[model samples]
Target: MDTCYGTPNRKIVLLTCNVDDMTGEEIGFAREIMMKSGAMEFYTIPVQMKKSRPGFEIRVVSKPGDADNMAALLLKHTSTFGVRMQELSAYALERRSQVIHTPFGDVRRVIGEGYGVLKEKLENDDVCAYAEKAGVDRKTAERQIYALLEAEKQER
Candidate 1:
């Protein structure tokens, strides 16, 4: 992929296809396959197709180098006969991961900063582990962890 000089981070490719014959489970499996094939984004949009049949328009974004593999996976895993690909430049935030210490356990937090703003979130796997160990739901565990972080900020 060519380096983009604009606000976007880099150049990428978008692959799209339309299909209506796959079941929900099949779509899920196709999504997993595309993700494993290094697709940066895999999503579907519902559309009304010919003869009033409902179908899904699958869209996948990938690095230019991975577009061929992503397209191949989509062709192999989905009900579509052909895939369309387009090159695009995309914006992305700078991101990093940190281990957050809590009373229950250590959680991996993903921190993103860019364009004069910053955001943080605990990794889902870590949150799930924390929830199980602390005997709380995921949302509750997240709240508690954020509360602890806020308290720590207040102290310092």
Candidate 2:
């Protein structure tokens, strides 16, 4: 199976929580729980509640598929009873992953283009191995290798 990342239509869902004001350690702990539950981005927004009491508004951003699990995580960690989830869609990009030959050996790079798309990034270990095998500098090998991928952008 091919390994890939950054898929098109990858929805970014925001999971927000309303909780009582607390210390940094408490907030950070909640943040960690939210992140491990599959949130890609996590943050806390400060808010002033009734009687000038301070609190935090926790927001968790993740893929659309993670909406349910993430919402549950927020509710469980922050003791929030309800959460609001919204869908935001946009065109991503067209990406293609390919393995090409280089003077050094083998290097990997992702080719991405503009709706849902993804490609691969070159692995340093792979490049080094090839460079060693080919008896060439890694930098030179990288330049020669990346040129092929650049040609793809020109084709556009």
Candidate 3:
């Protein structure tokens, strides 16, 4: 998974590939691989090629500090031998917090309150533990957390 790193937390790296015309299925597979490699963004915008033929712009986004990780993934998944990379400075939500209440404990996830929106933040592990201890369905717990987050959004 993509971890947050870099000073000021501008950790988004984009890798672009300009390969020969590729099929939609191939593009989809490439996207899947990119996401699995922890790419935050995987897109293929359509573009006109030579003779007006159709082509795509394959791009993968990762943490700026993860430049090496993104490049390795690009080299492994795409047909291109090299991927162009660029570093960008952006202001993202400072960060979100997850409270890991060990078995049978209550977790009060304090979503970033200063950000544009405020809500409860429950990660997959949180839901799993809640379900395992509370005897609730994992999906149900996920929905519950989503509901809480949504309610908090409305309050903000």
Candidate 4:
């Protein structure tokens, strides 16, 4: 498939660690810090640790160069002593941004092209703003925006 934007050439690094000593609030703070520090994605999975004690497995995906920084952040913010690292080839879809007119106003969307298919995602802030302006529920505003996008797509 032809990319609407230029192809990306880079690798993705995944950093994972298990933390059993930190509280839930610390974990949440770590997640935010990771994102702000350039982590592409961050999440936690609930798990049972030694003696069946509750714990969490934190996962962070980032650019190859940012692995060490993210790992340090994980260790510094969380109680984890060590982090496991892995490198993987990353294939990203070409993406572009466009503003489309909707009943509420103009909204920006991120459109991605991959595998001969095009997909678009509305910005969350835009959806919320539209919902408030239109005095409609969030879902209703989202649906109206999607319908407008679909109609525009069909016109192309």
Candidate 5:
């Protein structure tokens, strides 16, 4: 089987640390901060720590050059004493966005193409807003937009 993505084009670092002390709101704030500070991706996974305590591991993907900065941010924002870093190779799709004009309005869609695979996804928020203004449900709006895209594709 052929893969949908091409070979890794970027070298990134994964920074992680386990913290059992912060509240949910605090973690959310830290996540926001990380995103704003140039973290490519930030997430948390629940885990059990020592003494049978529940904790979450903060995982951040960042550019290799920013690994130290990201780790410092994690240390300053979280209760963890230290952050771990691992370099990784990433394979990603090349993506672009287009606005399709329809009866409802202009709807934005993200197109990703790589290794002969093409995929498109409509923005949910745009669909929802248009649906409300057009007095239709989300599903109806989405269906109409997709149908229009399909017809355009067929014409081309």
Candidate 6:
């Protein structure tokens, strides 16, 4: 486990493998299996392998405790015979969720505090749902939510 100084921290394991023989459908299946097996994040990068063959390098991020399970899943679901593992530490800012009433509806905003400053972002799903419910475009809904948040900020 890796530790951070004076901040909330998490230890994660990164697993990477190069695969040259799996179809797109098979890759999607492997991604689902990895997610179900405790992979926090899974993605692939296109690369050219030996003999000029197009392939992908699959990368999986998992909690330290789930490393073994993730590795096993990768081995079973993908065509990779070997995996590279690395331990990593991450530090996150303090954050909290606040529900605000907007013209569209109630929306949740994530407020993060770091470096003596506050940063905020409106939840994407909430904004999308509000757009659907109000029959407005997504950009319009996003602007409305931002305007609401700005008003609240001024009030504070």
Compared with the true structure, what per-residue lDDT tens digits does model 1 show for residues 1-156? 555344987799999999988999999999988887788889999999888999999999999999888888999999999999999986777899888898778999999877666888889988999999999999999999898888989999
Model 6 spans with C-alpha error above 4 angstroms: 1-8, 103-105, 115-117, 153-156
Report the lDDT tens digits of candidate 6 across residue range 30-142.
99988887798999999999999999999999999999989999999999999999999876668899998877788998998764556888899999999999899999998
* CA lDDT, every model vs. true structure: 0.89, 0.72, 0.70, 0.89, 0.92, 0.89
What clash count does candidate 1 reach? Answer: 0
lDDT of 6 at 19: 96
Candidate 3 off by > 4 Å:
1-9, 97-156
Task: Enumerate residue pairs that collide in model 3.
Answer: 11-63, 11-64, 12-64, 13-62
The candidate 1 region of ten consecutive residues with least summed lDDT is: 1-10
Error of 4 at 32 (Å): 0.8
TM agreement with the true structure for every prediction = 0.86, 0.52, 0.56, 0.84, 0.87, 0.80
lDDT (C-alpha) at residue 130 in model 4: 97
CA error at residue 81 for candidate 1, angstroms: 1.3
| RMSD (CA, angstroms), candidate 4 | 4.1
Clashes of each: 0, 5, 4, 0, 0, 0
Among all windows of 10 consecutive residues in model 2, the one with the lowest summed lDDT is 1-10
Candidate 1: where are CA atoms >4 Å away?
1-6, 151-156
TM-score of 1: 0.86
Candidate 2 residue lDDT tens string, 25-87: 877887888777778789978888667888878788889988998887777767567788877
Clashing pairs in 1: none
lDDT of 5 by residue, 1-156 (tens): 666455787799999999999999999999999999999999999999999999999999999999888999999999999999999997777899999998767899999888777889999999998898789999999998898989999999
Show the colliding residue pairs in model 5: none
Native-to-model Cα distance after best TM-score fit, residue 154 in candidate 5, in Å: 5.0
Best by the lDDT measure: 5
Q: Which ten residues in a row have the lowest lDDT in candidate 5?
A: 1-10
lDDT of 4: 0.89
